[model samples]
Target: MFSSKIVTFNKINFLNKLSDGFKITNKSHREYFNLGHPLESPPTLRGSMVVEFKMSFILDNEEFFEYGSPVDIGGLSAGYIGLENYKASDLKVNFFDFDKIISEISAVRFYERQKFLEHEITESVYGILKSNFNNDLADFIRFDENPHSRLFEFCLAGGYKINEDHVQKIHIPNTYKNSLLMKRISDRFKGRVLTFNPKYGFESRNVG
Candidate 1:
């Protein structure tokens, strides 16, 4: 049962998705700095960005939730509609490991689909990756499942430096090498490299 999925949408877009019945299980701050990124610059400074998080578009429509992004959106996204809890906050302050701050802020939760049989979690998760990020930068963020620890394996992996809104360019990280889950699109990446926590793309969220 996939309780939640990773997503990237601003508050306005998020509200629209919610109008379509997408419930937010949790969310990550749209502001983040990739590892090795100078701590002096965070995400918020770049204005006109979207809100990204873990979400599930299922209330009574589980089918809508499952085969939508990969099948319907057609590689426009990746990752399971997972969960995270990040309240409204200011995206300033720099020169520190944001992993610590994000960890402190996120109280992740999943809005799983009803599971009838016991399927291997890895395949399902991996499948989502392949469906969503088959051709893109799948080698970037490979931290989805490690099998031992059950938590949101949030890592600043591979992403793009899109120049949107003209505020400046942004580093939008993909989830992994298999799936560039549009799960999280942060304005943070002024870049992605370096691991403050030693383990960058090794763990995963055990949603069982």
Candidate 2:
């Protein structure tokens, strides 16, 4: 089974919020990341600029399988609202191969969401994603589901560079290509490829 996580950033107020509300059962952990010196190790550094909320979700194998089913969210059953405070800004997302660090941070949110949704797990998750990411780029979004794993996929445009402020412009590599397994959006704007870890959820601003 797969897990999910959502991270939000109120760029205006500079507030960060992370939630693991998309799990199979309801066992998740949410906390704030301390970017202070010593603690600024690997994981912390990767997530440094974040200030305020840090959350997580975790689920066991049995519970995960039971609630990881997929549901369609096209019409009424869909609980998505359009993006809030829509702004012309840049966003980036990154997909990682299963590793210990990724698994641990992601597991917290994955399990938490499962527990939150005693039922209606799939539909609820779909709604949340649609509401949060439904922009001019919605068509670029994708998902992966398997008995043992699951993943959320998407692409970003608009000159956003990795490890830089959203306002800065970056050039995309000319080698970028589109495929069934992966899609590329290359134009005058900077394009980035992103995939979310179904288990760990998402990170605000750090989507690259």
Candidate 3:
């Protein structure tokens, strides 16, 4: 699904853009402003008037994926409505998967790793040892913090299943350390772990 949080500002210039107002210049101050008050007449006018508008859009997966560039939406060039004066916060959009995309990715990674190992250990005598290792790894894979509980349950329902019988433990060192196991975990969970910051807006298309 696709979602958007939009804020608009209504300013005097907006009326001018609509060709409903005349520009009145303050010659002494070298400044110009719109004279017409479309909503309220001059006698009833107060100081300057500003309005803020905020709207959210939620679209289905197909629509969301089809969103064109922001520039095509008129973006900042769209006449102010009052949105500029108000500070809009907490704008977020996340794509959730009903199917266990993370688990699928993890399973693929495990299969690839196992295939690589099988190619290296060519000796038939090590078949039993390899089988034991695979079983242990699969057990470890199933041992999440709470196996019964799903991550981001409220936002996205359905649970992912751990399929591997033998997976490696993630281990990292302080010195230029890179653990393949840790990388797998990060790749699987990165989408859920990262969040949009109010101070710095962010956007994500997928949960895995």
Among all candidates shown, the one with the greatest lDDT? 2
lDDT of 3 at 107: 39
In candidate 1 the C-alpha lDDT for residue 82 amounts to 25
Residue 75, model 2, lDDT: 14
The C-alpha stretches of model 2 lying farther than 4 A from their native spots are 1-112, 115-121, 135-142, 145-208
| lDDT, candidate 3, 36-100, per-residue tens | 11111112222222211111111121122221210112212353211232221111112333122
What lDDT is reached at residue 74 by model 3?
Answer: 28
- How do the residues 78-114 of candidate 1 rate in per-residue lDDT, one tens digit apiece? 3232212211121122213222322322222231111
For 35-128, candidate 2 gives per-residue lDDT tens digits of 1111111132222222211112221111222111112212112323232333222222222221222343234456545532222224444444
Q: Give each model's clash number.
A: 28, 30, 14
lDDT of 2: 0.25
For every candidate in turn, the CA RMSD to the true structure comes to 19.1, 19.5, 27.3
lDDT (Cα, 0-100) at 133 in candidate 2: 47
Q: Pairing residues by index, what is the TM-score of model 1?
A: 0.18
Q: Which should have the higher TM-score, number 1 or number 2?
A: 1
Report the candidate with higher lDDT, 1 versus 3: 1
Q: At residue 173, what lDDT does model 1 achieve?
A: 28
| Model 3 stretches with alpha carbons more than 4 Å out | 1-93, 96-145, 151-208
